[model samples]
Target: MYSVVVEANVQYEKESFTIVGLPVVPIKKSKECILSYQHTLGIDITMKKITIHLSPADASPPSQPN
Candidate 1:
């Protein structure tokens, strides 16, 4: 089993999106998902600096021997 902690910080001064603490592939995908979800609700995140962090980043799912 694995655990991940997600945190988001939004700032109105600049337009930037960043993810920290983890290097998972899906983290990139999360940007797309957030964009789509925001679009659905008519929210503009373009002028905001968004920061996402994943804690316990070293944790990974348990693997089973084949």
Candidate 2:
């Protein structure tokens, strides 16, 4: 198994949200959930650059034996 860490950066820019660094499908789909939470918390981030980075960015599964 591998240990992964998540880091988020929010910057001022034209409205956009992005997730980088080898995110899985479920992670990509979590945008709506996140936005909902943000709304519930009363933090409007519609006009900012949101970047979520997953690190060690180059993680990969071990190769199988031949």
Candidate 3:
């Protein structure tokens, strides 16, 4: 299992989400992963514009909030 650094995105006017910074597959999965964590764990995580760079950049990308 690889840990991919994921950044979140919320579509305007709609509650839909998008995950950026990971491989397309994992990033897609992150949508559910993050939503579950926030919903069940009660972490009101929201998304805004960001810039990411993960260590070993290829492994996982990190993001900086703007």
lDDT of each: 0.77, 0.74, 0.49
Q: Mind giving the per-residue lDDT tens digits that candidate 1 earns over 1-66?
A: 567677899999779988776566867776777678879999888789989876574676447999
Candidate 1: residue pairs that collide = none
**Candidate 1 segments whose C-alpha is farther than 4 A from its true place:** 1-5, 55-66
Off by over 4 Å in 2: 1-4, 22-24, 54-66
Query: Per-residue CA lDDT of candidate 3, range 1-66, in tens?
Result: 654443433433533344444467755565666567778987653443323322223553336799
lDDT of 3: 0.49
Comparing 1 with 2 on lDDT, the higher-scoring candidate is 1
Q: Return the TM-score for each candidate structure.
A: 0.60, 0.60, 0.43
lDDT of 2 at 12: 94
Clashes of 2: 0
- Which window of 10 residues has the lowest lDDT sum in candidate 3? 48-57
Worst 10 residues of 1 by lDDT: 53-62
lDDT of 1 at 19: 78
Candidate 2 per-residue lDDT, tens place, 9-66, comes to 9999888888766558856666666777889999988789999766563566447999
Model 2 CA RMSD to the hidden true structure, in angstroms? 7.2
